[model samples]
Target: MSTAVDDDLWSAVGDPTRRRMIDRLLADGTGTATSLSEQIPVTRQAIAKHLAVLDRAGLVHGATAGRERRYRVDEAQLARAVAQLNAVGSAWDSRLDRIKRIAETIQRTGGGSTAEPDTEHRNEKE
Candidate 1:
C-alpha cells in the first residue's frame, strides 16, 4: 500500500473506541447492534455509527439475521493491514541495521573524529 493510504487505514484504527470495538468482535464470533452496545460504554445508536465507519473501512461486514443485523470482522482486510505494518517495520529494521554497520565500521577504523558529523561534502581545499 502507498504510505499515505496505509497511514490513513491505521489512523482510522487508532481510535481507542474503535480498537475496543474490534476487540469485542475478535473475542466474539459475531455481534449485533444490541450485543455490541452491551459490551461497550456507548449506546446502541452510537454503536451503529461506529459500525458504519468500520464497514466503510472494510474492517467489518454486517448481515441481516432475520430482523436483526449481525457484524463480523473482515479477516482479509485485517490481514492486509497486518501485512502493511509488517512491511514498514521490516524497512525500518533494515535502516537501523545499516546505521549500526556504519558505526561498527567507524569504531573498527579508529577515526580521529569519533562522533563527527559528515564534513566530507564540505570544501576542504582552502
Candidate 2:
C-alpha cells in the first residue's frame, strides 16, 4: 500500500535535471525558469517543464511574481524525501551487516569451499 507521495516523489526526483533544479532552487532560495536556465544547461522552456514535474511531486512550489513564476523548494516535502532516503539506507546497511556476519562465520568454520574435485563430471580420460 504505497502512497501517492511514495510513488511520484521518486519519479520526480529520479531525473538528473530535476535534481539539479532542486539544488539550484535550494541554493538560490528562489528562481524563475529563465534564472534556472541560466544556471543549468537546458533552455528556459525545459526548465519550466522540470519545474512542473517537481511541483507535481510537491518538492517545489511556485508563485506568480509579476511576469515570471518564482519557484522554491518545499521544506516539508524535502524533509520527507530525506527521511525516505535514510530509511532505504538503513535497510541496506542492515542487509550488509547480516552478509558480513555470515562471511565471518564461514571464515571461522573454515568451511568456505571444498578442495575435493567433482567426480560426477569426470571424463573417461580421468
Whose lDDT is greatest here? 2
Estimate the overall C-alpha local distance difference test score of candidate 2: 0.89
Instruction: Tell me the spans in candidate 2 whose CA falls farther than 4 Å from its real position.
Output: 1-5, 115-126
* lDDT (10s digit) by residue, model 2, range 29-48: 99999999999999999999
Global CA lDDT of candidate 1, please? 0.83
Candidate 2 residue-pair clash tally? 0
TM-score of each: 0.69, 0.82
User: Could you say which candidate leads in TM-score?
Assistant: 2
Worst 10 residues of 1 by lDDT: 1-10
